[model samples]
Target: MPTRRRTLLLIAAALGLPRAGAAPEGGYRFQRGLMGTRFMVTCYHEEGELVGKAVAAAFAEADRINEAASDYIADSELLSIGKVPPGTPVRVSPLLFGLLEEAWAQAEKTGGLFDPTVGPLTRLWRESRRRKALPDAATLAKAKAAIGWKKLVLDPAESTATFTVPDMRLDLGGIAKGQAADRMLAILGKHGVPCSSVTAGGDVRMGDPPPGKEGWNIGVRNRDVDRNAAELVLRNKAVSTSGDLRQFIEIGGVRYSHIVDPATGLGLTRPVSATIIAVNAATSDALATACCIADRETGRKLAAAQGAEVFLAEG
Candidate 1:
């Protein structure tokens, strides 16, 4: 709710030529560096004159997706829903609907561990960090009360989102990356263009890398290394990573992760990181977030339930 914000990261695209076995189809490659994060977009066809136009078109889609899910912005659709009273019909695009619906399912499957209604909690952390402080148990508990998916009433009939708890807020930054990838894939296909991919920071959605190529090559990344770097391999699938290795703050020599566990209003310490591969980006994204908050068993169960291939890195 409150429209989504950049509590998440940000993007663009520059396509590469066919390297040996890369996809056969050719297109214009564009790079985008907007949002807080950077990524690239590549299409199957274009002309020197159309280069600028194609870049604009691809990023226009990214911009729309970002606006819908960013918490930093105040007028995003997600934010609009937070302000609306329960049961009010709100028109939403198919991509947003799918993202929210999947987010709802993942939250239930994870037993609130992956709840999207944590805008208030994340906002607290953002403020707490800025204030050079952390939330006390009392404050955290109160914030936890404001978090839960059941409190949301979503109606497909009218595409309405209702909040059962007035204080409850939804945050899609954690899952919107996948939705964006899915939408981009659709848009690319609609144009009958082939051989390309889109990457937003760590989340990447790739097609048959120009034809003849096996698939999208990816590296699960060692966060200990440079963040901008990743390994390369063919993995015709969506992959995501979550860990306490990075994005943490040190207090008294103890590191606290940025990824919060909705179950306890804190973050998980064990299982340093989790990398999951799934057919859909949203499932992998949601599961990665969920696994970060769950124990090994719980994570395993949920991963299987989601039909995701999960590899847990023991700490």
Candidate 2:
């Protein structure tokens, strides 16, 4: 086998599948680092070469999504929306337009708790975390002023996005990975690899169960413990976990999570983990973040309204 093929086949062995056990017989796994994290695709197919091609195509699709929607990328289509003059319609790719549509719908469903307009605040908190301090009142206030889901206008007919407020950046960190994983899974299915799972960080989108298994076994981690708090068996569904478990910083002996609550314009101070299971990865991913920011009862209600389930754990 060539070096590239060897590396693709070795990803399954080297990194190991998350507590889901080995891929079924005739399964092929591929992994690559994309969008600031590891993206793994495992598919069961009779032909090894075909599996390799399908996984490669899936990764390619993931890369495309990252290029189109990444907030971290200076020239991404998503960031380009911020560069346009305020209130000017900026035509975007159909993919980005559809994604923004979904995000807008999710924001409305969650009553602005899942706002993509939280980008300004996200950047501010990111800098604060790096410096091990909180943003000053003026800075936080400025960021908050730029937020508000209503300020985003999506014209479906023109396939454009318009920002009504200046500095109205969009951070899709809470939802973009799920969308990428969903697209990768679709790519695998189109390639005749239906029994597959795409794992992008904490987001997992499963297509069909392994050859003999009833469903994929996914482990949900607790906020405080190293071990998984729950093991779920699911198929043809998506699951995402968002929390401060590992992504947090301590300032003045108080820990703050990387997840910023749009309501407060600051990272969440409470140690909580939110897991959302829904029909698709994007819904689950965004809901997981919203659930983390909401109180337990409200979180459950929020997920339930969207035909999703929420599991909340606090340390």
Candidate 3:
């Protein structure tokens, strides 16, 4: 698998001091490296010790999810699946099975715009970026041949997945971080942390507003201006962004984003960034990717269908 890419979104810290009764002393914040990116959790709780334990649990949950889904991990379930013979069903853990199901559904919903089967394309681009050159037409063709969500077979009942085409690979990098953030928030909730937020890189998931605030304030970065374009007050929601600004390769005076178009085996060129706010981090993350691959109108329609809002920045 290709080396992991940097988180594509930037989230500004909430501005201002916590309101009265936010926590006994103040909200506790914790950050750690997980899933090849920084995962942070902030919680409001009466007991500092409880907050610590809850944060630890949340991070642990994130790590567990990452271990199961990360394609960069050599022994990860995702990589193990790729190692299996084509057309041979390989049973996966419950977590991976569930995620695979969700990914397939999202891929279908977006007409394959958001596909986990783009691993081959991702690797090709990564190599091209490393070499400071574009992949040759033959190599690009081979990579494209290995991409197709329809070619991946999933058996939910048996918790098994298979690739119809040889050398096909799956990469959950597009959606796993968002799912991990959501799972971390769930772990925090299970520990009785009522108001909290978990950010797995760019995918931010919040349970509720702080003790006295209407909603958590989040900043959406504008790469063209190198400033925050807008700050959104959100509660019980998730936001994610996909862009080429920070993670891209320049070749022959043209910029190629890390966000690849699986359909064409090429990186997006026009849209500099795409952001989405939705009811869940996973959906928001997948939709953000879909927005990057689609035209503005089509992207907006996709987000609207899911009761989410999308912002696309183009040159």
Candidate 4:
């Protein structure tokens, strides 16, 4: 549950696009702390009360999804599955089961570049970061042994999941927030709020453009420049970026990113940042994590294969 913080930088307002509908007197924006980060929802509506109700409903949906997916929460459905004995099938909620299935598929697709089973390794790295030292070889080996998507079995019909190895754990941090954003947008849509945007950490999901604007311009922050590295226009699309610039540890004069490589059970060393733009935030979020682990060419190819655009910054 102690995941790396996102380097979102900024979500800029609409640029010089023409307003399409009757320009609302003003837009409504709300921000809340959720999922260990800031969640903001913005809508263009004539009535403040309507926007407020839609924002509340959207956030409530986000809360529900986060509770089910969060590993930090002891009673979360995900942790409940972690407590089950090896090879014991446990029925899970539709959301958890679907996410696990998606995680498995992505793990296979990316050659384990993005893995939910890396929770043990993630914990090891967190402790290593805390101690300001690298994890010993023996400890890394033990954690690595408990990781592998192939070791997890899912029964779709029964909606049951079983881990083949004892103590195997799952972490959805990479994709959960994006998934929550996607769901939040759906909730807003259900409330008849057509033009809106929801930002959960670095993952962003936007609906139609505000009034007459062509699209929302999301600024990608460049830590080195202390300004936006670039801007992406988004409408009915999502963007996610992953990097170690903001969340990492220094040990023995070397910097280790919080984004770990499951294969080596070690944090990434390259000064690389990957941004993925896809149809949904979940895909963008998970693929961005994959890009962090993959080589430059491989990451680009993977992103392209998914019909997503990728931008990688290597320093």
Q: Find the candidate with the highest lDDT and give its number.
A: 2
Q: Per-residue error at 282 for model 4, in Å?
A: 0.3
The most accurate candidate by TM-score is 2
TM-score versus the correct structure, for each prediction: 0.81, 0.92, 0.90, 0.90
Q: Write the per-residue lDDT of candidate 2 for residues 135-175, one digit (tens) a residue.
A: 88998898999999999999999999999989899988889
Q: Rank the candidate models, highest TM-score first.
A: 2, 3, 4, 1
- In terms of TM-score, which candidate is stronger, 3 or 4? 3
Candidate 4 root-mean-square deviation in Å: 7.8
Off by more than 4 A, model 4: 1-25, 222-225
Per-prediction count of colliding residue pairs? 30, 0, 0, 4
| Residue 158, model 1: Cα distance from true site in angstroms | 1.5
Query: What TM-score does model 2 achieve against the real structure?
Result: 0.92
Tens-place lDDT digits, model 1, residues 12-67: 12232111112224444444554566656654443333433444555567778787
Candidate 3: deviation at residue 234, Å?
Answer: 0.6
lDDT of 3 by residue, 207-259 (tens): 97888889988999746646788999999999998897788888988888899
Tell me how far candidate 1 lies from the true structure as C-alpha RMSD in angstroms. 8.0
lDDT scores in order: 0.66, 0.86, 0.82, 0.82
Ten residues in sequence with the least summed lDDT for candidate 2: 12-21
Candidate 4 global CA lDDT score: 0.82
